[model samples]
Target: MVRSLKNPKNAKRKSKGSKKEDGSSSSNSVPSMPAKVWQPGVDALEEGEELQCDPSAYNSLHAFHIGWPCLSFDVVRDSLGLVRTEFPHTIYCVTGTQANNAPNSIGIFKISNISGKRRELVPTKTSNADTDMESDSSDSDEDELDNEGPKAPVFQVRKVFHEGCVNRIRAMTQKPHICATWGDTGHVQIWDFASHLNALAEAESNISKDASTVSNQTPLVKFTGHKDEGYAIDWSALVPGRLVSGDCKNCIHLWEPSSDSTWNVDSKPFVGHTGSVEDLQWSPTEPYVFASCSVDKTIAIWDTRLGKSPAASIKAHSTDVNVISWNRLASCMLASGSDDGTFSIRDLRLLKEGDSVVAHFEYHKHPITSIEWSPHEASTLAVSSSDNQLTIWDLSLERDEEEEAEFKAKTQEEVHAPTDLPPQLLFVHQGQKDLKELHWHTQIPGMLISTAGDGFNILMPSNIETNLPPANATA
Candidate 1:
């Protein structure tokens, strides 16, 4: 279900040592290094001159240099609206396990904007030449922070925990301080990061330079039920401690946290799909409802009140539906991406037993790896295709009224018409290889992070300017 496809093509930090919760001495430091001198867009800045990013630049894609690369990752915004990026190590996984026999690690990076001055990142095109040159020198450069004014972008590595591949990570909505991680080992783990965040903050304020390693730090809770791995897990937004996970065995397990603070799993698995369950997403508004898509090319909506059978199921694609996302704005609106390089947006309210696709987008030439609805805008969502392009779609703009209405009116559309004119393809971002996931920053309306084989990208869509009215201006 969570497989990496082929090319498209597409930061350093410092550390210090301290004691961790597990009584292990480890290097505890957030990512910290002086900003690089290469102006984002070619010739955008002079030598020794700091970057003064335009306010509009925040609406476009800007790639940053995280010291390491990534395969899977998650972006979680804290209560203060600050964005934090968490992902397992890219090179460390291979070398650490093979060479040192060390457990895989997850790196926590906090993004900050210091804005007393008008410093911002310029829109830079990462050409092939620049990519080659920076590959060797960019990460290891230990340049000091130059006087770029107070508005420069800074990233701090809060902590790095010795763990596993961590194929997937999702932050809890009800308990923002907690997040869940799952991997190829078929283990699901819960982690409470409040104390770690605090410790990082204290170190930052005190400017601790001694590096520390967090070894054998255990998860808050761990559970295992699935015989096969490579599935998706989600925490219910409507119900605290309630979780639903899907696996390759076509089984869905429902879990609830008990009084003893441990998860309890149901003996009976929710079985319906003929193939592997690729993804599962819970209803933003309903506690008992959720939806799952599978390699069977079908998407099923399940209600916990019912037994293992799905309340509604539809043949969604010609190939495996690799991923599905629920529209945060419209609860019934759902989007699904398939291995056939196609994706569709469907209104579950108008769905029936047969093929129930509302609008089909076929721009992707490879498998669509990830699709996500924007938390700030109802009709806008972004999708990453294995073709190495991250395209943003806006359903509210320039849509054909007649076709949309006809598509919605039918209980089921037997044949999906090839989108004569594609839905408004708002923006296409480049410069990432094998892009796996894209997530809109919940606190920052226009910002979203993409994790891929090359590294991480913090991008602002081309149309983000529209979301930046005077009332919602951010730093």
Candidate 2:
């Protein structure tokens, strides 16, 4: 069982905030002009109310309950037993109940509604529900006629690799296939889901004969140079064979894969961050150009064209820079978030000789953990902070008309034209705890996935709907 971290409310505070530069309060506060709250539906209830059925079983359960409903009961139940599988649309529960004279065998069931003739109850299906139903029915001929009828979903917990808690998870695609990266103390393994599914089938064929171990499993390619823990990793968008990784040693290393299926480390190391380099991103347009942010309160842009030193360095924040993202639409644009409770956007094309203060945001009060740009829209970006909030911004929309007109006039002669409207503050998603990562899907740009220290979540733009959620929804 994985233990939950102590809530931030229990943490000890260091000092009260000092006064601001303009004599205003330095402490963060909600606006005096209250904004309207959006209530999802009429079935909303306060924190501690118990519903008729398990909320986690249904993806649409949140459609009934708004905001953060109390999930202690759900967590307690999960702790007491085990969930066989948590899919995008359903949750499978496994229970071990006595059957014959021998030890009880495991049975699995889907925890969803079933309606037959007149009765309605939660439906239970086997793990192989699509294929093994006929075999299950033939094996239990005697019990089939016992009335009380078909049993309610019988939960049989399966042995899942990273079951209870997952600290971090990332996915990478190599041509027609995809692999997942999981953070663990053991050798970093990339599980090929397609191959693993086939292995499970082979294991099942030998189950009755008591020889079920599948020895054909492939191990993941591990990077072992980092003596300390590896904290962050980013795949090169331009070349999937190359990747960049950061470690707790305050060092960043570039890795390239060789034809012999081995990874080679580049001899030169990027070593300017006084503290650990927390984040790194490679520009999509400029493959050789990448950015790195660190606890040393600096953000540096490096061009592989330059042998060692960074091309440009900016004193980005008052504290550690935790996250950074490059705008896919705007080739010269980049954004970084920091522990100093601020995020800044810079234009690589414009930063020359004497120009300072590109564009900065001071909206977040706590450390910003992750920043992401919209894959479909260049001007849109989203950020997640330790304060448990995700804010979306449409950067193309300018707030000041006079300033926007002047900016347009100044850059109008260029080939590309700037939009007149100020970027829109799309929406704010709150109630998560200590969000650490945010990733927008490549195929569907509006959809995003985020993982926090508390739990994993998926966020879709309010206007969009998806038939099936992404596989890594609950990372």
Estimate TM-scores for all models: 0.72, 0.56
Q: Please provide, for model 2 over 48-82, each residue's C-alpha lDDT reduced to its tens digit, 9 standing for 90 to 100.
A: 22122111112211111111111111100111112
- Give the whole-model CA lDDT for all candidates, comma-separated: 0.63, 0.48
Top TM-score model: 1
Count of clashes, each model: 23, 14
Worst 10 residues of 1 by lDDT: 90-99
Which model scores highest in lDDT? 1
What tens digits encode model 1's per-residue C-alpha lDDT throughout 1-475? 4464221111111123323212344554533323321211222533323332222222323344443445556665455423222221111001011102445555555555422111122324455454333232112112233454122344455444635555677777766557777766787777777665555545433225322343456788776778777557788878888988888889998988888767788868899999988899999988899999999999999999988899988888889999999987788799999997899999887785454567889878788989999887888889998777788888877867796666555524243233443657766566577778878777656666787776666655334533443453222
Q: Cα lDDT of model 2 overall?
A: 0.48
Model 2: how far is 87 from its true place, Å? Answer: 17
